[model samples]
Target: MEKLKESISSVLPVTGIVFLLCFTISPVPNDLLMGFVLGAVMLILGMGLFTLGTDLAMTPIGNHVGSAVTKSRSVWMIVLVSLLVGVFITMSEPDLQVLAEQVPGIPNMTLILAVAVGVGFFLVVAMLRMLLRIKLSHLLIAVYLFVFLLARFVPREFLSVAFDSGGVTTGPMTVPFIMALGVGVAAIRSDSNAENDSFGLVALCSAGPIIAVLVLGIVYGDVAGTYVPVAMPQIADSKELWLLFLTAFPKYLKEVALALCPILVFFLLFQVTKLHLPKGELIKICVGLVYTYVGLVLFLTGVNVGFMPVGSFIGQLIGGMSHNWIIIPIGMVIGYFLVAAEPAVHVLNRQVYTITAGSIPQKALSTSLSIGVSISVGLAMLRVLTGLPILYLLVPGYLLAGVLTFFSPPLFTAIAFDSGGVASGPMTATFLLPLAMGTCSGVGGNVVVDAFGVVAMVAMTPLITIQLLGIYHKYRFRPEEVQEEEAASEDEDGGDIITF
Candidate 1:
C-alpha cells in the first residue's frame, strides 16, 4: 500500500497538470461533461495499472535475463542476444509507435522497423563496451561527432525527427528492463570495476535510434516529405469516450505482448539451460508480469484516448489565444513538473544517488532535469511560433552538448546522454507532442518543420544541463581539496595559524 502511494504521488503531478491544461485550456464542450468524466476515469486506471506492471513484471524479467546472459562465457552469443533483445523490445515501444504514426514522410512500419534495428545494433555495441571496459565518454565523443558530420548531409526535415528518435525510442517499457539487463550483465563479470559498466546501457541504447534515423535520411535522400497532421478528436458523449478507450486497449495489449515475448523466450531458454529461480520467486515474478500487462493496458488506453487529444487541444487553444506569449511560461512550468512524474526518472535518480553514496542527491538530479526540460519546452514553443529549421537549434545544441562531454566527468556524460532519452518518456509523447501539433495546426505552421522537434528539444536540453551540473560539482569539489592542501603546506612550514 505504501509503495503504491509512492508510485501514485510520483505520477499524479504530471497527470494533474495534463488534466488542468486540458480543462483550463482545451475545455470540452459543456454538453460533453460525461465524456470528460469517462476519459478521466480511464486515464487514471490505466496509468496506475501500467506503473504496477512495470514494477512487477517487466523489470524483473529483464534483470533475470540480463544476469543469466552474463554467466555465459561466450561473448559473441551475449552480444548477439542482447542486440536482438534491444531491437525487439524497442519495436514494441508504445511511445515509439506514437512517434512513428506522427512522422509524415516515412512509412510507419518502415520507420518502426528501422529504429528497432538501430536500437538492437547499438545495444550490442553498448553491451560489448561494458564487457571490454571501454571508456563511455570517448566512445560518445567519437559517435556523436560522426553523427554531426552525417547531419550535414541528411535532409533538414528528417534531422529533428532523427534526433527525436533517439529520445523517444527509450520509453517506459524499455528503460527499467533494459537498465536491469545492464546491471544483470555487469554483475556477472569477475572484474573489480563491474559497477561502472552497468551505468552505460541506456546511453548506448540511445545512440541506436539516432544513427538509424540519420542513415534513414541518407537513404531517403531528398524525397518529397509529407507531414502527417494530427486530427483532434472531439468527445461528443460518454459512450464515445468509452468506445475510444476500448479501441485503444487491445492495440496496446497486443503491443506489450509483442514487446514481452522475446524476453520471455530468452528467460525460458535460460531456465532450460543454466539459471533457475526458486519456485516461489518465479511465481512472484509471474504475478508481477500479470500486473505489468494490466498496468500497461490501462496506461496506454488513458494516454491515447484521453490525454493525447487534450494535449493537442490545449496547445491549439493557447497558441490561438490573444495572449499566445503565455504558452512559453506555461510550457516551462509543465515541463518542470512533468519530468518528476516519469517512473524511469525516479529509478534513474534513485540509482544515481545510491551509487554516488549520497554525494549526488535525488533532489539535485530532479531539479537539474526539470530546469533542463523547462528550457527545452520554452524553446519548442518558440520554434512553433517562428518556423525555424530544427537544425538551426539542434546543430548548435548538439555542438554545445558534445563539447561538454570532454569537460564533464565520464559518468556525468553518460547520465546526461541517458537522461535525454529518460526525459522524453510517455508524458512527452502523450502530452507535449499533442501540444506542439495543436499549436502548429492553429498557427498554420508546417507540423513537420515546426512542431516535430519538441521531443528532440526536450531530449537535448538535459544533456547540456545535467553535464553542466556535473561540471559544477567537479569544480565545486576541487576548491575544498585545494584549501585542505594549502593548510597542510602551512603546517609543514611551521607557520602560525591565521585567524580572521
Candidate 2:
C-alpha cells in the first residue's frame, strides 16, 4: 500500500497534464486518450508491485551473488562471473529490446549482442575499479573522451541512438540488481570510501553500450534509418480499448519472462552452489519473482500499447499547430514530473537515502532530478525545433560534468552519473522518445536527427544538477563541522553497510 501510494503520487501529475492537454491545448483522439488513461492505471499498479518485488527478490539475489563472488577472493572468478552476469543482464534488458526494435537498418539481435558485449566488458572494468580503488572521475573522463573521439567517426544518425543506448541499458530491469551487486562487493571493505565505490557500477555500465553501438555505427557506416510513425489505434468502442490492452499483454508477458529468466536462472544456480539458505526465505523470493513478472508484464503493456500511441499523437497534434513553440514549456512540465514516475528512480532514491543515512535527503535528490530533467526536456524540444546537432550539447555537458567531479564530493559525483541512467528509464523511452519522434514528424524535420536524442538529453543534465547539489552540500557547512560529520559518519558506517 505504501508502494502503491508512491506510484500514484509519482504518476498522477503527469497523467493530469496529459488529460489537460488533451482537452485544452493539444486535443488527442478519443481512442488514444482512452488508451493513455488505461495505461496510466496499469503504470501505477505495475510500478507499485514492481518496486515491492524488487525489494523482496532482485536486491537479495544480487546481494547474495555479489557477496559470494567477492568472498571467493579470486580475480579470475570475479572477472568471469561479472562478465557473464553483465552479458546476460544486458541482453535481457527490456529497454534495450525496445530501443533495438525502434532503430532501423540494424538487426535487433546484432545490436543486442553488441550492447551485451559492451556492458560485459565494462562491468568487468567496474569490478576491477572497485577492487583497485581507481578514481571514478578519472576513468569517466578517459572513457567519455574515447566515446566522443569515436563519435566523430560514426554516422550522424547513429550518434543519438548510440548515446541513448547508454541511458536505457541501465534502466529498471538493470539498476536494482546491478546496484545491489555493487553494494555486496563494496561491503567487504571497511574503508571510508567504500560507499562511494559502490555507486559507479551503473555509471560505468551505462557507458559500455554507447561505445559498442558507436563501433557498430562505424562498421555499418551510414545506416541512418528512417523513422516509422506508430499506427494510431482506431478504437470505436470500450470493448476495442479492452482488446487493445489485452492483446498487448501476451507480447509483454513473453518479453518480461525472457528478461527475467536469465536473472532467475542465475539466482537459482547461485542458491544451489553458494547461497544455501532456509526454505522460508526462498519462498519469499519466489513470491517476489512472481510479483516482478506480473508487474513488468502489465507495465510494459500499459506503456507500449497505451502510452506510446497517445504520446506520439499528442506530439503530432501540438507540433502541427502554428504556435508549435508551446512544446518547449509543455515538454519541460512533463519532464519535471516524469522522472518520479520511473520505477527505477524510487529504487535509486531509497538506496541513496539508506546508504547516506539521510545526510542527503530524498526530497532534495528528487527535486534536483526534476529540475535537471525539466531543463533537458526543454533543450531537447529546442533541438527539435532547430535541428541542432547533439554533439553541441553532449560535448559541453559532459565536459562540465567531468570538471565538476573534481570539485564535488566523490559520492555525489558517483550518484549523479548513476542518476543519469535511472532518470531516463522506461517512461522516457516509452513516452518522451515517441513524443519527440511524433513532433519531428509533424514538423517535417529529420526525425532521426532531431527526435532521437531525447533520452541522451535526459541522461546528461542530472550530472550537472546533482554535482551542483554536492558542491552546495560541501559549502553548506563549515570546514570543521564537515570534518566532524565525516568523522562521525565513518565511525558509524561500520554498522551502516546496507544489507539486502
Candidate 3:
C-alpha cells in the first residue's frame, strides 16, 4: 500500500500539472482531457505494479545471474555471459525502440541491434573493470573523449539523436537488471571496494549506445532527418477514449511478452544448469514475472496512447502562443515533477540508498535529480527558441562532470552517473521528448537538432547535480574529520606537556 501511495505521488504531480495546463493555457477537447485523466490513472496503477514487480522479480534475476556467472571464475564465461545479458536487456528496452523510430536513415531493427551490441560490449567492459579494479573515472574519460572526437566527424543531424540514444537505452527495463547485476557481481568481492564497484555498470552501459550511434551515423552517411508531426487521435466520446486505451493494452502486452522472453529463457536456462534454486523460490519468481509483464504492458500502453498525444498538443499550444518563450519555464516546471513519474528512478534511488547504507538518501538523490532535470528541460527549451547546437552544451557539461568525478568520492561519482542514466527513462522519452518535438514543430525549429537532445540533456544534468550532492556530503561531513584532527592535535600537545 505504501508503495502504491508512492507511485501515486510520482504520477499525480505531473498529471495535475497537465490538468492545470489544460484548463488554463492548453485546453483540449473534453474527450481528450478525459482520456488523459484515464491514462493518468492507468499510469499510477502501472507504476505501482511495475515497481513492486521489479522488487519481487527483475532484480533477483540479475543478482542470480551476476553471482552465478562470477562463481564460474572463467574470464571467458563472465565476459560472454555479461555481454549476452546486456544485449538481451537492451534489445527489450522500449525507450530505445522509441528513439530508434525517431531517428532517420536506419532500419529500426538495425539501430536497435547496433545499440544492443554497444551496450552488450560495454557491459563486458564494466564487469571486467570491476574485476580488474580499474578506475571508473579513467575509463569514463577515455570513452567520453572517444565519443566527443567521434562526434565531430558524425554529421550534425545525427549528433543530438546519437547522444539521446545513450540516455534512453538504459531505461526502466534495463536499469533494474543491469543495476542488480552490478550489485551481484560486486558481491563476489568482500573487500571495501565492492560497494563502490557496484555502481558504474549503468554509467558505462549508458556510454556504449552513444559511441555506437555515433559510429552508425558516420557509416550510414546521409543521416539527416526530419520530424514526424504528432497526429492527435480523433475521439468523439468517452467510450471511444476508453476503447483506445483498451485497444493499446493488447499490443503492448505482446511487446512486453516478447521483451520478457529472452530474459526469462536465459534465467530458466541458468536455473536448470547453474542457479538450481528450490521450487518455492521458482514459484515466487514466476509470479513476479507475471506482475512485471502486466504492469509494463499497462504502463507503456497508457503512456503512449494517452500521454504522447496530449503532450504534443500542449507543446503545440504553448509553442504557438505569443509568449512562446514561456516554454522554458514551463519545461522546467514539468521536469521538476516529471522525474518522479519514471518507474526506474525509484529503483535507482532505492538501490543507491541501499548500497550507500543510507549515507546517500533517496530524498537527496531525488531532489538533486528534480533540480537537474528542470535545468536540462529549461536548456532544451532554450535550444528550441535559439536554434543552438547541442554540441555546444554537451561538451562543457560532460567536461564539468568529468572534472567533478576526480573531486567526488568514487561511490558518489558512480551513483551520480547511474542516476543520470536512470533519470531519463521512459517518462522523459515518451512525454517530455514528444513535448519538445511538438514545441519545435510549432516554433519552426529543426526538431532533430533542437528538440531531440532533451533526453540527452536530461541524462547529462544529473551527472552535475548528484555529484554536487556528493560534494555537499563532502562539506557537510567535513566537520567530523576536522574534529578528529583537532582531537589528535590536543592529545599530541598534552603528551608533550606531560613529557616536559
Candidate 4:
C-alpha cells in the first residue's frame, strides 16, 4: 500500500503538468489526452507492483546467487558464474531493445550481442574488483580514460550512441538484480570498506556497454543514417486508444516472459543445487515473479502507448513556434518531472538509503537526479538550437565527474556513477529522447547529433550533481564534527557521531 502511494505520487506531478499544458498552452487531441489519462492510471499501478515485486523477488535471488557464488571460493567458478549472469540479464533488458531499435543501420542482434559480451566481461571485472579489494575510484579513472581514448577514434555518428548504450543497459530490470548481487558479495566481508565497495558494481557494469559499442563503431566504420522519427498515433476515439494499450500489453507479456526465463532458470537451478530453502519462501518468490511480469507489461504498454507519442507531439509543437527558445525551459521542466517516473531511480535511492543507514536521504538523491536531468534537457535543447557536437559537452562533463570522484567520499563516488545509469532508464530513452528528436526536427537542426544524446546527457549530469552533494555533505559535516567535539568537551561525555 505504501509502495502504491509512492508510485501514485511519483507519476501524478508529471500527469498534472502535461494536462496543464494541454488545457492551456498547447492543446492536444482529445484521443491523446484520454490515452494519457489512462496511461497514467496504469503507470501508477504498475510502478507499485514492480517496486514491491522487486523487493520480494530480485533482491533475494541476487543475494542468494551472489553469496552462493562467493562461498564456492573457486576463482574459475566465480568468473564463469558472473560472466553468464551478466550476459543473460543484459540480453533481456527491455531498454536495450528500445535502444537497438532506434539506432539506425546496426543489426539489433549484433549490437545486443556486443553489449552482452561487454557486460559479461565487465561483470567478471567487477566481481574480481570486490574480491581483490581494489579501489573503485582507481578502476573507474583507468577505464574511463580508455573510453575517452577509444571515443576519439570511433566514428562521430556512433560516439554518443555508444555512451548512451552504457546508460540504457542498466535499466529497471538490470539494476535491482546486479545491485543486490553486489550487496550479497560484499556481505562476505566483515569490514566497513565492504559496504563502500558494494556500490560500484553497477557503476562498472554501466561502463562495459560504452566500451563495447565504441569498439563496434571502430570495426564497422561510419554507418551513417538519418534520425527515424516516431509516428505519433492518431486515434479517432476512446476505444482506439484503449486498444492501442491493450494490444501492446500482450507483446510485452511475451517479451517480459522471455526476458525473465533465463534468470528464472538460473534461480531454480540454484535453489535445487545450493539454496534448498523451505517451501514458503519459494512460494513467495514465485508470486513476486508474477507481480513483476504483470507490472512490467503494464508499465511498458503505458509508456510506449501513452507517453511517447504525446511527448513527440509536444516537442514538435513547441519547436515549430516562431520563438522556440522556450523549448529549453519547457524541456527542463519536463525533464525534472519525467525522471521521477523512472522505476530504477526509486531502486537506486532505496539502496543508497539502506546502505548508508539513511545518512543519505532518498529525498536528497531524488533532488540531485532532478536537477541533473533538468540541466541535461536544457543542454539537449541548446544542442538542437545550435547543432553543437556532443563530444563538446560529454568530454568536459565526464572529466569533471571523474575529478570529483577523487575529492568526494568513496561511497558518494560509487553512488554518483550508478545514478548516471539509473537516471536514464526506459522513460528517458522512449519519451525524453523522442521529445528531443521531435524538437530538433521541428527546429531544422541535425537530429542525429543534437537529439541522439539526450540519454547520454541525462546520464552525465547526475554524475556531477550527485558528486556535488557529496562535496557539500563533506564540508557541512566537517564543522559540525568540530562543534560536536567542542560541545563534548563541555559535557565530558561521548557518544557515536551522527552526520549526514
User: Which of the numbered candidates is closest to the native, going by highest TM-score?
Assistant: 2
Candidate 2 runs further than 4 Å off:
481-500
Please list the residue runs of candidate 1 whose C-alpha ends up more than 4 Å from where it truly belongs after superposition.
15-26, 30-47, 190-192, 223-228, 477-500
Which has the better lDDT: candidate 1, or candidate 2?
2
Q: Output the lDDT of residue 82, model 3.
A: 85
Mind giving the per-residue lDDT tens digits that candidate 3 earns over 71-123?
88999999999888889889989888878876666789988998999999999
Q: What RMSD value applies to candidate 4?
A: 4.2
- For TM-score, candidate 1 versus 3, the one ahead is 3
Q: Order the numbered candidates by TM-score, best leading.
A: 2, 3, 4, 1
| Superior by lDDT: candidate 1 or candidate 3 | 3
Ten contiguous residues with the weakest lDDT in model 1: 491-500
* Local accuracy of candidate 2 as per-residue lDDT tens digits, 1-500: 99899999999999999999988988877888888989999999999999999999988888888888998899999999999989998898888888888887788999899999999999999999998878788899999999999999999989998999999899788899999999989888778678768898999999999999999999988864667788889999999999989988888888888888988898889889988978999999999999888888878888898888988998898889889999999999999999999888998998999888887899999999999999999999999888999999999999999999877777888899999989998899999998998888889998877898899999999999999998888777565666566557546542222111
Give the distance in Å from residue 369's predicted Cα in candidate 3 to where it truly belongs: 0.9
> Residue 319, candidate 3: how far off, in angstroms?
1.2
Taking all chains together, the TM-score of candidate 1 against the true structure is 0.89
lDDT of each: 0.76, 0.89, 0.85, 0.85
